[model samples]
Target: MERIASVDEIPTKGVLFDYKEGPFDEQGILVRTRDGFKAFKNECRHLPMRLDDREPADIWDPHGRYLVCNSHGARYRPDDGLCVSGPCEGSHLKELPVVVKGDEVYLETDKIGGFFNV
Candidate 1:
């Protein structure tokens, strides 16, 4: 497990974190919802590209209800990483396992083997 962030560090806009998958460096997004904290790969379902590829850190829609892929306008649910609209509708974002321990969030790197095809 790798410590990613503290619970208090996650904002309404969410937090972007970096981790390693084998020798490759990858990014994940950590979000806090009504249910609890959720984490997902920064890649969009429609394509193997970062959701904020076009606009740095501009991952959320104007209303902040959904996470928007700036390149393709795909909107994903913050709580479940489900693409509800746009080209990737019916698809879900690749989720990264995360556990909150004593106010710190840890990425379950062991569970991520081969998931990212890296």
Candidate 2:
């Protein structure tokens, strides 16, 4: 496991983090939701691109209830990473395993295998 951020570091807009998946450098998104903390790869299911690729730091829609893919207008649920609208509808974001310990958030690197195994 690798420490990513503190619980307080995650804001309503969420936080972006960097991690290593095998030999590749990847990014992750950590959001604090009503159910607790959720983390996912900073990627859009419709394409091999970051959701905020077109708009830096602008990953949320006007209402802030869903995570929007700036490049394609895909909206995803922060709690489950499900794309509910736009081109990627019916698709889900790649979820990353995270654990909260005390006041810090940790990325379960061991659980980050599968497609990221490389």
Candidate 3:
């Protein structure tokens, strides 16, 4: 994992940001969870499409509970990237470990896996 952006770089709330994990890393978003901060791969489990591929790159609802993929309106939990609705109901968003050091945010590339790699 390497430092990419800071908390300020990401929107205060209900905002999504695209982050890099490594050379072969997948695109992800840094979210502000009620417990703290978390990240999830932008790719959707239903297909190889990135959630942000839809018109709105960031589709977090006002309540900020889950991220909605604009492509097919799929909703996923930010905490663990679990799907709650849409075609991929039984699937989950690939979770990426993220660490916030001081004011900088780092994505943990070593543990990247789940729906995609499988």
Candidate 4:
């Protein structure tokens, strides 16, 4: 696992990750919830485009109840990364494992991202 960012750095809404390993690049989103934190690849189920196509902070729905895709108005629940409405309904966002230690957050690059597998 590699420390990606501080827990404090993540906003209450969410944040985008430009995760890269050698030539492998994947966009991700991290959302902090009352239970803890949830992370998922930024790709939407209906398309190859990112959910945060406009901006990371803009992913939230109008009422801030879910993560809204700017392209097709898809809404994903922050707690479970599930699409509740839109073209991708019934599909799930690809979840990534995360660990929170003290004030820092680390991505399980090996189990999920293959960051330093050599």
Candidate 5:
């Protein structure tokens, strides 16, 4: 397991990208949803392009409902990383297995699925 970010760094309703320089490889995100922290690959399902153009938390839709893909307006459910509406509808984001211990967020690097290819 690799600690990525502290729980205080991520808001309860915001998201943050784990830079490549961190313990994890490749671009990934840690979202603080209503339920709790959820992680996923930063790549959009449409292509290898990144999903957020700016800060991850500011890339939501007009109503600030879903996570909107800045490149294509692909709205995804932060709770499950599911693309409910967009060119890639029905597809889902590659979720990362994460666990929060104390005040730090960590990812089970060794258990990352092959879909990430990290």
Candidate 6:
């Protein structure tokens, strides 16, 4: 059930896709890091707000290490899915398991909530 995307479809940094239905109500930003492709639920743990409120852009930190919630200054490390700051310090970015097959990227839709405790 992984949603596949071509390498061209995804930017070198990352791309945001809106997930209005299915398991995720909010959008998810997929990043192409040194490790591999990764995605996270695009909502801030604090105040239950969308992370990209003002800019409506994909959530990404200047350092490229974490996706940032600019609204409340929350930072989520893309590597291990940890919130390093803000009210949701102990919380983590909802991880979306993904795989890159050849030039396509797919998300494991079946295990969305169950695996990540979403």
lDDT of each: 0.85, 0.85, 0.70, 0.80, 0.74, 0.71
lDDT of 1: 0.85
Model 3 per-residue lDDT tens digits across residues 62-106: 576678888898888876778899999979887668788899777
Instruction: List the RMSD of every prediction in angstroms.
Output: 3.3, 3.3, 5.0, 3.3, 4.6, 4.3
- Expressed as tens digits, the lDDT of each residue in 9-29 for candidate 6 is 886667776553345466677
lDDT per residue (tens digit) for residues 1-118 in model 5: 7777788888654655554424445777778777778888888898777787645535667776677788877878988999998899988888888899999888776686322322
Q: Model 4 off-target regions past 4 Å? A: 54-57, 116-118
Clashing pairs in 6: 2-107, 3-107
Task: Kindly report which residue pairs in candidate 4 clash with one another.
Answer: none
Report the lDDT of model 5 for residue 114: 27
Rank the models by lDDT, top first.
2, 1, 4, 5, 6, 3
Clashing pairs in 3: 81-93
Please identify which of the two predictions, 2 or 4, would achieve the higher lDDT against the true structure.
2
Q: With candidate 5 superimposed using the best TM-score fit, by how many Å does residue 46's alpha carbon deviate from the native?
A: 1.2
Residue 45 Cα positional deviation in candidate 2, in Å, after optimal superposition: 0.4
Give the RMSD in angstroms, all C-alphas superposed, for model 2.
3.3
Error of 3 at 108 (Å): 2.1
| Winner on TM-score (4 vs 5) | 4
Q: What is the lDDT of residue 61 in candidate 3?
A: 61
Instruction: Determine which window of 10 residues in candidate 2 has minimal summed lDDT.
Output: 109-118
lDDT of 3 at 114: 21
After superposition, candidate 5 runs with Cα above 4 Å error: 19-25, 53-57, 113-118
- For candidate 5, the per-residue lDDT at 91 reads 89
lDDT, model 2, position 18: 83
lDDT of 2 by residue, 48-71 (tens): 899888955589889889999988
